[model samples]
Target: MGEENMTKTTTKALMAAAAFSVAAPALAETELNFWSWRQEDIAGYEAIIAEFEKTHPDIHIVYTPHEAKAYNTILTTALAGGSGPDIIHTRAYGSLENISSAGYLEPLDGQVDLSLLSKDELLGTTLRSDGKVYAVPFASQTVVVYYNKDIFDAQGITPPETFEEFKAVAAHLKDAGITPLANGTADGWTIEVMSGAFMPNFYGSDFFGQVTSGATDFEDPRYVTALGKMAELAEFMPVGFEGVDYATMKALFTSGAAAMFVGGSWEINGFRDAGLNFDMMPGPSAEAGGERMVATWMDGGYAVNAASPNKEAALEFIRFTATTPFAQMLTDQLNNIPAVDGAVSSDPMLQKVASFHSAATPYIMLVAFRFNKPTGSTLLQTGLQELMTGAKDAATVAKDISDGIKNAE
Candidate 1:
């Protein structure tokens, strides 16, 4: 061949090589976005994602953590704009209902193997709604009574079992010049549990169910009794509780300024890691001298965005989170329970927290998911806060909660 012809052939070969490289399967990588509430959650998630990426080299994930306060609002705005992450964590039953109803979350029942997972691993009520599952159970944190063992021993007081004993202890502590209970009433949700969980024990487990189902009136005697008990408890709590928040309240407990505190199991790890000497027991029951059982609520779970472009990948992520090292990490490292079955804690404090849940008899109260709407609990929270401040009487607070539910309907 001539010199010019040879040069043209070399150029053509170089162009074909570049085209082949561009068209290769190695270049076809799938990317998905995930949004979550906790910044700390990202580190664990990233560790999982790193393993996942190694297994599936073609998939790349982008994870973003949002501050808890900004989480739902940001997700709402993104969903409205038709742009958001492929996966997100949401509140348990009621929240799942709202997001699913709004067409923002995909039904995850058939996509994941629910039967293989243990019923105990999940918040049981969350797994089904009318016999159909909507989201994958992720992390669960249950509320429990946190007591300073040193204080209880020093005061010669045992942790309260029944409501009457609880009152006696509070009185004893008060007389001893120690606040029997240290709580942060500034958080509206804290106050709601006092009225919604602690007091409702007098009415039985089905009390809230009846109210939610509209079978009972809001002005019923049961609700009034519960509200009254809440006010009574408030009178015995430490002063300046209204100005406190969870962090401050936790600090007080860790610093040994308070004898007893009520919070979720999530705080156990923090307290343990802080080297605080504390013991946990169930909250007081309504029946005098009855078994030490109390109302409880679910904390966290994973849900897939209905509008996600990478639905399959998101479902896989949910499955992973509900299983193995990720599941164990939630309980082991973060001091939270896994939504999967057979999850146990190696940490002694977490082990106690789990034992309390296992020993719960008759029923584990569903205090949080009282309404289907997202704002239902908030309304309850607001009413409880007003009641605590004496701005609203117990009857009016009860009426307001009932009225708010009616309006939500």
Candidate 2:
């Protein structure tokens, strides 16, 4: 062939090589499945997953979120079957026991540096019997009274310091044709939340330590007094509150028809999204000049399934979740108190909520008493519901809890 014809053939060969390169099958990437019950946070998890994949081109993560109510059953069933996702979004405290104790979770202790968390923070993920940590603590939830600033300003009310004053404030709100407290006994868990959020202020700060240490039981006079204080709140709740559900109760507050709501920090994002002007406070002290305390708990965490095929990749992702950047991302995206101590959020409401943490106590039933069957949490919820409905008085309810689960640990 002539020199010009040879040059043309070489160019054709080069173009063909480039096209083949573009069309060739891509290298197989390790696929990791991360399962959680946060179905609403798919976008937030997607952002985190994208960031992880950016530096880890060889690993791909799929976030699978189940319905929150059904998640525990689904996860336990899958794990028991000797098959589950690579990364599991496990609940904290006693909720982690069944999975970890059953050998379904990969013990995360030395594999992931949970050193960023303090010993107290790590308690949420540590197995009680073995002392083996199974997951990275993800977030901390604080329970407080959320008040609508717009209504409070209009009603000329400041946060009431004493239980009597709080009741008076509620009465004032009611007289103005507004629902003073947006709560109902219809939802069992919300009742437990209210009891957690407000009872410490009534029982005094020392009761939690005493009850949890075996020095006292739920039937102690102090606890009965606290339950009595919680029952007093029934009179201040929205009219016909007995029939209202959690969603309707929240709507009553968000729509400005109610003045205050006793709820958790997890409600922050939803309140903000509704454009409601609000602030939160630890509940009123039992008496004037008494110390006020808030209730807090470790929400949940991420763990690796012991049977996962992509264990290394799952560990990489779990380690990433333990980092400050990921914590910050989670805080910014979800407005949560990310469990990492190094992670900080500039959100004004979160900052205020954090301020309340200075005097916070562990959410009583969950942190101290959820490890066994007929958990204190179950008893508290049922007792509180009965107390709220007048079907049981404070003393009876307290005795019921003490009889049911005080010695569970």
Candidate 3:
């Protein structure tokens, strides 16, 4: 009575197991889409993604990077279309605020563990208007001067110790037929980069406090001095310097035709990739042995799209970023300061650039006034271009900035 019935039950059990296996194919691995503005760092990010995949075999990240300048439009269009990447690389401060206010980002405060980040890093991603955090900070950058080490050694000159000596060094380089500063105004942003050093050097630390507090504005005598110092160096730049764009200016220095370039720490990887021997300095002080300062800002962060279908997977990746291994890998590959703790680039130049934070000031236009009407940054950039030409004086530039930022609060 039992033998035939047992065989029939076993056959049915085998057929049921086969059917279950077929249905299980629906549970494929989760894939997270990551969008960024760092089109150049694609390889670096790929290495990062590969490392993360080594542990979480159940999840995969597909990285898609857009041109930095066009990213805003691209992201806005995607979000407006009711579709976007699962993870977004967001700009800090006002830019972050713009999208967060529109509710495009997942509020990250309690969702993502961010104990690895410093207060400043969190503050950079905080939407001021709402007082809530939205992303995990990735990097912070300083605006400092990059000088060709070979050029400096060839001319037997060290970095200047004071403002006057700074000018003297420029004169010396000029006499040696080396373009002293590769910076120029054809790119409006480079002028702002130069100000990162000039503003703190010429105006002193208190100036930011005074200007921010409404006790004074950019029209102060100190700001005029900063603009004047920028103008005074025109003779030491490349011929027809006002027409030199950022790429050409970078070429002048990287090619050894110019001695120095004032730019953001973001330039470190590019200069290194160019095979140039270079180092950075916080521009000189007002007096020998006095303090020096450079402008700095949080570069931005990794965020989860509010409507992401794979939030758990996206957040696991963010959690990996907060780990020391991931932070060090990011630092080593990107050659930029990681916003997380326990990872500093052993690359000496990046280390040196990070050292500027000891005397760093918030990048004035970006950190403070970018949200303002007309934008103090826009006013300063345009004003500096005019100051470099003969169209406007330092005082006039100073007045223009003061007027533009009067409502910048």
Candidate 4:
């Protein structure tokens, strides 16, 4: 052969070798079908998976993001039918009540390294029972008061620090021709915030701890007092709040139509993205200058499917997700504050919210976590709605909630 022909043949051989080297791992990689409730910024998730893939060259990820509203129902149906993702993200309450009882989740106590997380950092009570952590907590969210800076400044109302001051502020806002609170009571969960989140403030820590433990009945004096306060405050809220939905109420605050909104930290991104400047202050105190034990709850975490055919691969996938940078990516890029300590936040709004969460003492509230008895979410919603609509008195509402717990238990 000519000298040029031999050189070309050697170059072709090198190219072929490189191609096979890349294809070999690509063909060898084990695949995991990972599913989530929403597309919810898959780019962030993908970044984590990419990093995991680099480490485990023999593993691959199949990402499937589902519709947020239908994910739970669909996941349950699929699990029953024997076909689902290798790993799934689900709500804490749903996981404990629905998935755990169904035997769909593998107990993760010894499987994942729980010692890396702090007891105070995780949603302390929500993620653990019997001294074993079933789920790896991913995020802790608390209900807080988001207020329009312009409105508060214009009305000369410093954010209310006490229940009495809260009432006066609301009245002042009303007199100033602005709705005091941008509450959307039409949704059931909003009612839950008032009953489950806000009411505990009125009852104080000890009373709430008793009710949560099922030691004191839900109809205790503190419970009634909280309901009465919610009823009284409802009158000062916007007149058309009954017709509002979550998005609408969020818009009301964002657009400056309403003075304040009380909700969880999940909406921080939306508020930030709207480019509307606002300040998140403590919720109006239930007592005069008393410490507010914010109602913070565990959002969700990684759990291996008990019946997954690819159990080892599923576990590898979860281990990678839990321990690796991808786990941090879930919070960092996606704007969630992960249960992992030192999970940094780039968004100033998230940092602000985290500051509030860090400032809260007594750590997790028992009522928020539904600790011992697991407060009936449906019953709590109904009771609060009745109070807001003037359909039930404070004492009657408390009794109904108490009875609802008994029936469930």
TM-score of each: 0.80, 0.90, 0.88, 0.81
**Cα lDDT tens digits for candidate 3, 305-361:** 888888777877776665556677889999888887667477887878877788988
For candidate 4, give the lDDT of residue 14: 44
**Top lDDT: which candidate number?**
2
Per-residue CA lDDT of model 1 for 232-347, tens digit only, reads: 77767668778877677777788888788887666665777678778887777878654455554556567788888777767766655544445555665566666654345787
> What do the candidate models score in CA lDDT, each in turn?
0.66, 0.84, 0.82, 0.68
Which ranges in model 3 have alpha carbons more than 4 Å from their true place? 1-28, 407-409
Model 2 stretches with alpha carbons more than 4 Å out? 1-28, 406-409
Backbone clashes counted, model 3: 0
- Pairs with backbone N, CA or C atoms under 3 Å apart (clashes), candidate 4: 138-339
Question: At residue 316, what lDDT does model 2 achieve?
Answer: 78
Candidate 2's TM-score reads 0.90
Ten residues in sequence with the least summed lDDT for candidate 3:
18-27
lDDT of 4 at 257: 85
Instruction: Name the runs in model 4 displaced over 4 angstroms.
Output: 1-27, 38-43, 57-69, 119-133, 324-327, 344-348, 358-375
lDDT string, candidate 2, 184-215, tens digits: 87877788888876788877778889988889
lDDT of 4 by residue, 139-180 (tens): 777777888888888888787788788889889988888888
